[model samples]
Target: MEPVTTGLIYAAAMAAIATARPKWEPNRGNERQYVLRPADISPLSDFGIADAAVYPVSAAQFPSGVDRIVSELNGYGKFGGDWNGEGALAPTAESVKEAIDFIRAFPAGLALPSPTISVGGEIGFYWSSAAGYVDLQIESLGHASLYIRNRKTGQDRFDDDIDWRTVGRQWYQEKLSILQDPLQIAA
Candidate 1:
């Protein structure tokens, strides 16, 4: 074979190998782990509920509460209640424990269903203080914000879209069973 032809073949082979065996670097920030922050009442309250004592609150209350909880827990600075933003709310250790407690202890009279926590990704699940028996699950993947609506309607639906990055797919899969039952995990 001609020298130039041999060089071209070698280059083509290298290009093929590079494309076939792509290297994936670990996320330096390691965004998969859940971060917790101090509990705040203002945003929680303003998110729309006058009192959590009520069995069923409006859906409007959930976003604000979720934002506040995420902020208090993650300490990613202020979230501005923008669902599409990349920022997350990490709860303090104590607050995380408290949140787990509250969800587990949620009154039976309220008839709230157990929550499924989707960890290690842009999608997160949490109970709303505004609605005693209701939970808010937010999913943001830098494309759009998807809210899983579990109230008002009898079916779960995607309400909207927001932009964010998703991480920790493995954590979510492993913790699926545990997240389904806070009481069982707590016990």
Candidate 2:
């Protein structure tokens, strides 16, 4: 399957949300969570807000692509065995939640990474271009693996068992610097 662009994902989400109505409910910590349900579907009892990808209204103004990523991950979390008709394993709820948290905390001004799910059910995000490539795989809530390749300098770095919660932003800034300008790093 061809990789889906963030723009396409955003467009599709907006189209779907266009016909939906918002219904608000109080969640943990008294956050005002709202679900965008289709006009035809009545509001159902809330079982798991996470399962529904419901978020507080304040986060609705999140940067572009965040909502699309959340929607995509939620759909992936609902899949069962052989979700792809090719024996691909479905991602666990824990992994999905981890991925969502990581994405929500991503630094601003950088292009949103492309979210991917491994056949073995791991959730990951990657950025690739002629300049370089970077991949971050979520193993659990705070654990992950990172792989970076600099085509210009022929340097490859892989770090496993990383705690993203502690240093994800600063660490990615250093690694992704290669993507911003491979020549500068090569020099």
Candidate 3:
């Protein structure tokens, strides 16, 4: 085959593969794919706050949650009126980046699930699990308000000002126990 023809065939094959499959991820269900990681970009001018209660299924997934939070950072100025709608706040670039850094800095020794990222008017960024959640409110560079809550036990605690790095995984280990499976709860 001519060189040009061979190149065309390879290009077509690659496109076909991309269309048929997304990258795979483990520790997640087989359905997992490279849907997250490297946040997807959209026109911030068009970005409007949705009913945050129903978080996107994509944002609920692994690293995808990280992507969603990062992408939404531009929403900071989207709300022309009071940015805080029913307690819905846009995330600041600093806080969003810090939240991500906190997740990355998490102790590898802990098997904590990836947190679903959410925003609040009062809070800057939030990382949550069925077990517990953390709130990060950005202050000056390298400083933030950190809050942790045990959902099931209703143990809520926070520091109005501190560094996220100061939090230890052992604290989360204790909070994780508070999360009981809903199925288990039903039984």
Best by lDDT: 2
lDDT of 2 by residue, 35-79 (tens): 654453444558532323443464454324667787898888998
lDDT of 3 by residue, 2-75 (tens): 99999999998878342311232222332424433234433345655332222234323554433444445434
User: How do all models score by TM-score?
Assistant: 0.20, 0.62, 0.38
Clashing pairs in 2: none
* Highest TM-score model number: 2
Model 1: what TM-score?
0.20
lDDT of 1 by residue, 128-186 (tens): 42212233443322333333332333444443443223324342233222223444446
Full-model lDDT for every candidate: 0.36, 0.76, 0.52
Worst 10 residues of 3 by lDDT: 18-27
Error of 3 at 154 (Å): 4.7
| TM-score preference between candidates 2 and 3, better one | 2
Candidate 3 wrong stretches, greater than 4 Å: 1-63, 77-81, 84-93, 103-123, 127-136, 148-155, 166-168, 175-177, 180-187
Query: How many residue pairs collide in each prediction?
Result: 23, 0, 2
